[model samples]
Target chain A: MSLPRHVIAPAIAVLAASGALLRRSRRRQRSRNPRPASTREWTRHPVGLVAGREIRQRLRSRSFSISVLITVVAVAAIIVIPSFHHTSALRVRVGVAPGTPSATSALITRDAHALGVVTTITSFPSVSALESALHRSVDLAVLSSQELLTYGGLGASGSSGSNFLTSLSLSLGQASALSAAHLSPSQLQTLQSAHPFRIVALHPPTPRRSVDPLALVGVIVMFMMVNQYAQWILLGVMEEKSSRVVEVLLSGLRPVEMIGGKVSGIGFVALLQGGLTIASALIASYAVGSPLVQTHASWTLAALILWFLLGYVFYSWVFAAVGSMVERIDQAQSLALPFSLPLFAGYIYSIFEASSTTVSTLYRALAYFPPTALFAMPTLVSRGDVGPLGFSVSVAIDLVTTVLVARLAAGIYRRAILHTGSRVRWGDVLRRGR
Target chain B: MPVLDISGLRRRFGDLVALDGLSFTVASGVVTGFLGPNGAGKTTTMRAIFGLVDLDEGDIRVDGHPVDAARRQRFGYMPEERGLYPTMKILDQVEYFGRLHGLSRADARSKGAEWLTRLGLEGREDAKVDELSHGNQQRVQLATALVHDPDILILDEPLSGLDPTGIDDIGAIIVERAREGRAVVFSSHQLDLVENLCDVVTIIDHGRVVAHGTVDELASAGQPRLTVRVEGDREGRWAASLPGVTVSEINGGEVRLVLEDHVDTDLVLSAARAAGRVTEFSLHRRRLSEVFRESLS
Candidate 1:
């Protein structure tokens, strides 16, 4: 960039006069009395010291307390609120009439078991009573050997009542046929216990998938954690720079050590907060009789925490570098936009994919990409859609990317931090590095 | 005495040359006043000494050994722009800096407290830096620099923005550090205060040392000055006809004449007498400010 003459002129004059003064000083025979020094050892673990300070400061800040409290409340509400509504287990009652076959009750019970619902059977005195009891006393009733009744149709054909009716009709017909054939007990037993053919196909149907509701919740939690903690690092670095404390710190510690310590410190606090939130969720679920407590919870939480760490470590360095470039809060916000875009994009896409039954190719592709993998891979893990190999590969990619990002961020941070007068330009810093 | 030698230092900020072949030596047990005009690289040089600025080409050494991180750790620095963590407690902030410089936690805390007390911030150690007045914050800033008990102190504009009491307090601390046999260097625009407080002054203009010597030596190096007042010479035009003497100041009937080395004081007196009956006449050595101006000019 070309500087105006107004700026260039004084600079030239200063340089010229400095050169002149240099000649003047050279002419004089100046004396040099060098100071003797002892080699004193420095703290070998400066990064740890820096990180330790960050941890203490963050813990003491009121914001950390507030954030943890808010997270607990939010996590508890997510686990507990679903148990309050229709999202919980459904209860069905079946009334059996006197004339119905003794096997009818067994069949209905078996059907309900297959559908993963709770059911209770009550024997009524007569068919009229069974009809009368429908809807009022029971959800369904067996009127006779071949007849059954419901107060209303059991939703669509795809619903529980239709399924129960189909299974019952098949069982009763087979019973009637065996009775008419007059088979011996052994023959009848052999016929009744015959196994159905195991259906295998060259081109199998796509596996059924519903969003693992818990995993969806986990993705949201992970997103919140990674985003919030990364921002904490950004704001923390900005505070040091804006307050001008960074210069003093950089004097005692290298820039890399300063930033490394900050990231590590904040990352530790983030994990602690994540653990607290997860614990609160589990406790809240248990207290509220929520089924989420039993549904592959340990593995789900472990995946969530692992991904949160990966996501945080990857993003924290970038935010720290951005923080060092700008001193004002507004400038930090603006400069942070480009980096935050990827975070927001990944979060939004993950939410969509987690909520959807069929994962798109884009979502699958994103699972392997480092930035979005935090969301995508965890979502797949939650739904049991991913294998161990897929998870490991995604994790490895993120780890490698994290290493690369840290080096780049450290470079930028070291270069930009000491330039104080105005916002340091990335181009200028990078150019200077070259 | 410990000595710091900065030789052949050069740094350019794009088109602006911040430091150009800047060199000087500072010895222990004396306050070296680093003087320069705005943009003359005083702060830049101070920063360079602490390795805050990456020199394009040069070396900074202490006792004929190159300064590295381990060496810089023992050097205390107070930048021209005062900075501290505003939300941090005064003592904790100081202790943090001390710990950064390799002090043990217990030592850092104790030394931080001691410095706070010494800087007149005894009761305010628990207060957040932002809660204090500007002068008190500056005190806290200085405490952070001193908590590590560094062997060399580089303070840039330490006296700026201080009240009379603040100035006196900080000035005394600077002198005390020197008396303790530490190599102390501070930069300020207050030449007169520098004259009184500093044992030696290194004057630089445009990133190079124009003068470096004891205050007395630099002050006495200027051509003699004659202050003459004539009874009726209100315009003070008496010395204008003299070939080698230049009137530096004129007020009412008095003029201060800056004489060239060849100028005779007797001729100056005769000119003042020609104008009017002389009311007062005296010759004195140049002030440090005059030497600073003369060297830069």
Candidate 2:
């Protein structure tokens, strides 16, 4: 489950580059008419060029930048806010008169420590000075031997403020009683240091919730990312078809190349966005010392990344074909809504299952269903509910299905793209093969 | 030898036949005008040549070989529905198409720039297609088609929606490409322009080629027509007594008469002379519009 991203990332890049270069070289050699030596040059890979255009356009778009920024900020807030609250609540500062007794100071420090708070004590010139420093320089102050002063009288019940006040008051009251008893310094020390009776539970409580935070988070990210990127492919193809640009493109490119280039171009953009989101989460988790990153994180992250890619490829082809059938944006949406049902079903089910301690039988079956597998399989991987064999089988099924889907989509796209009078019906196209 | 040969092209969209055994040859160094009414299968035939349309029955050949993807790369097409990437820069879009046709990046860029310049889109290479005027977008569409310097140009209504200057510029480019040894076949309803610009004309109706020949040949194919202009007669009242001499057109003092094959030219001349002093007399073929109308019928 732990992927070698560094090795795999660069290896995939090198392979893509090699394929492009090989295609260019082969195309050049295949040219029936060779130009003069001065004019001879290698043609670039068409899919790469098409993909490059998509990448450049998307990268430069305002919406893309804005979306990434928003995602990063939202992710940072989700991680950093809880940590900030926990650290702030445990910290307290106290002010006292200059001549305050050492024993009283020790009692205050000991009480705060027992309450699981970190206290900072400072001396002022007089009682007036100590009182004045309350809630400004310190949260609380010792105005006199008999009185304790706080700006808001210890905060609401069950808060860290109320807990600290209760502990400090009991310690101070005990010290005053001991002074009246005229106990010796050794006796006083022993009394103050005496241990409280331990209350042991007959039955220890276990955590009621067993959700895997990473899996839950992964499901949400995969759903949003896949849905978003798939829509882009749909819209892009719709633009080409509605504008009648496909005719010119088809004149020069095979339908397969066009669809392949389009999916690849947008897929890379989606990958970049997914990578950024993952990286941000990792960095923020590390910075805040969150326990969410501690359990099976590497493998879960790898699964999320792998599934995102498979999910995107599977949906993009289906969306692209739908795009080609309609000439208007509204028509595209209407047609795309039905095709998007599987994505929604998978997403909703994955989210529900990701939050449970145990995976359901239906969820496991859905992992093998190509459309829902994009969501269900990755969630299973993240939760450690699926083994390597299950994961591999799902991946293999998806890949084979993707190839078949791609062929079917390309065929439909080729046949229906040029029929402009009305939205092409899928049934008619399939039956007639027009 | 013909640069492009489309034979027995047939396509059916359900019950409607878009192309019915359409056959035609387009020779290099000649501009062939494809004439057809709406839904007469011109677009279908053109699309078939580029492999854009799957013909149920047809064979398209280029340079005596079957037209495949490689051969298609050497052909430029301007569809009846003009389209370009609205968000893409004109030069980049053109170059993208050129590269798609297998031109090197550098070559595509260079050629794209050259085509844009030739199409009078100079100084606007960076402008997006959506930012251009309708005529300018049309120019950009043509630039995409011509950027690869294709060997065969199949343009569907290339002259539609162009200003006179735009028309002349594009019309000249079409003729120039053909003169440079590229086979150019363009479909248009503008018969006058086609008649003036095309070297050969092919007229199709109901998806079949009804007439195919040189401009002069098709115009002169049927029975000869005699035109007579009388000094005093503003109408063709002089043809009343003449048999097998039917008036095809009469404008002012001139009368264009469609004569029977056995009709005597001397009798028509004597009849016109008897009515008024014969100022003009000549025999010539019908006009292209007339030929086109006749072929459709």
DockQ of each: 0.34, 0.41
Model 1 accuracy (lDDT, Cα): 0.80
Give candidate 2 regions above 4 Å deviation.
A1-43, A87-209, B230-242, B249-254, B273-279
For model 1 chain B, the run of ten residues with the poorest summed lDDT? B247-256
Runs in model 1 lying further than 4 Å from the true structure: A1-44, A86-191, A194-198, A213-215, A284-303, A356-365, A380-397, B231-235, B249-254, B276-279
What is the C-alpha lDDT profile of model 1 across B22-99, one tens digit per residue? 988999999999999999998878777766777899989998988866777788989887789888888988988887
Clashing pairs in 2: none
Tell me each candidate's TM-score.
Answer: 0.85, 0.81
Best of the candidates, DockQ: 2
Docking quality tier of candidate 2?
acceptable
- Residue-level lDDT of model 2, residues B1-297, one tens digit each, is 797888888889879988888888999999999998898988888888877877798888888898877678788999999988889899999988888777777888999999889888899999998899989999999988898899999999998999999999999999999889899999999999999899999999999999999998888888879889988788888896688987877877778888999998998898888988998899988888878887997
How many Å off is the CA of A212 in candidate 1? 3.9
lDDT of 2 by residue, A1-434 (tens): 33344224433553565477557745754474333343233225556767878888899898888878877676767777878776454777888776555567898888787877788888888888777777788888875575777888666888767888887877777777888798888998898789999998889774344676676777777888888888889888888987889899888777877888889989988888888888898898899887659656776677777777878999999998898888788898899998899999999988888877677899899999989987887677665566655666677688778878987998898888888887888786676455
Give Cα-based local distance difference scores for all models: 0.80, 0.82
Superposed by TM-score, candidate 2 places the C-alpha of residue A108 at a distance from the truth, in angstroms, of 11
